[model samples]
Target: MATEWLGLHFLFGAFLIGAVLSRGAGEHLPRTATQETRQVTLILLLPAYFLLAGLRVDLSALDPSGFGELALVLVVAIAAKTASAFAAARLHRLGSRDLAVLATLMNTRGLTELIVLTVGVETGILDGNLYSMMVIMALVTTAMAGPVLSGLLRPAGGGEQPFSGETAAHDEPLPARHAREETG
Candidate 1:
């Protein structure tokens, strides 16, 4: 909450609180705590946030110029986020397929971006047109993740299950970890 005094967004305050709590309660959190938290946050909270953000978007505000600006924003955002993630992931022993998946997934920037944009509109930092454009940009960029990942991961043969874990994900370690959890 103190972040507002520094002219920062309240999202920073919430994020800071979450990070501090997670760090403090790392050992104290029960086994299912993480799973339960994830389920609640993703299944329940995220959709509500998205809906609230969607309500404020005025489609009429997006004229030809706005559409052009939206296009440019999408290109810059997708390229920047994907390239940075790809470069960072290159340090690992992942293959091209896994790297593409990881990089694309990292570009999923919806909730936080929307929250900031919504606040910007409320605070008059963004006009109605810019808010609509930015909101659409946030949505479109995040929305591309699923189809893009499917395309990147899809086999040339167009199989139902595109790739196997041991191969596509290079997730050999997950199997071992799950096996340990099952018996223990």
Candidate 2:
């Protein structure tokens, strides 16, 4: 109804309706039904969504003239996201491995980027060539996130502490005395 009547994107409308419905009736849903819905969404709907997005992509719009600009944009986007996340984590005194993982995750531009790009094209805010480049950028950044996070979180020489609660160097369990002092 939002999509047809209000000119909103189908994805956006569905998300808004789902959020509203969940707030009102999520706890009333049976656990099994929720689990099955999640499974179906993941196993079927998500793949179809990506396939449709890929089919809609216009590869012919990727011209050599804009290749350099696209590359620069991609680099800037990834770097800015990672750097900002890393800096914020540092301010919070997150461990090195945790900081790296956070930065890598922050660099990912996945479904949200696709939604924005789709809307931009629809509204004539981006030309086909620019839209294609941004889509490519989003794909590359999202694809890189997993591998980069694994590498960053991997222990070096099997000596480094893992980022888990039991092993994190900077996140040791607080002594009762210190905890009381801080909280009191």
* Number of the predicted model whose lDDT against the real structure is largest: 1
Residue 56: error of model 2 in Å? 2.4
TM-score of every model? Answer: 0.67, 0.78
Cα lDDT of model 2 by residue, 1-184, tens digit: 7685777667678778877775547678899998899899999998897787666678765677678878998999888998999888777666666777888888676898887887788778888777878888889999999777677766776554445422234446335434665999
**Cα RMSD, each candidate:** 6.7, 3.6
Global lDDT of each candidate: 0.77, 0.76
Q: Which lDDT tens digits does candidate 1 get at residues 1-184? A: 6988888878788889887785557667786997898899999998998788888888786778878888898888888888888786666545577678878887787877888898898778998887888888788878889899889877879865543323334556445645776999
Alpha carbon RMSD to native, model 2: 3.6
- Pick the TM-score winner: 2
Which pairs of residues have clashing backbones in candidate 2? none
**TM-score of candidate 1 versus the correct structure, residues matched by position:** 0.67
Candidate 2 lands at a TM-score of 0.78
Give the total clashing residue pairs for model 2. Answer: 0
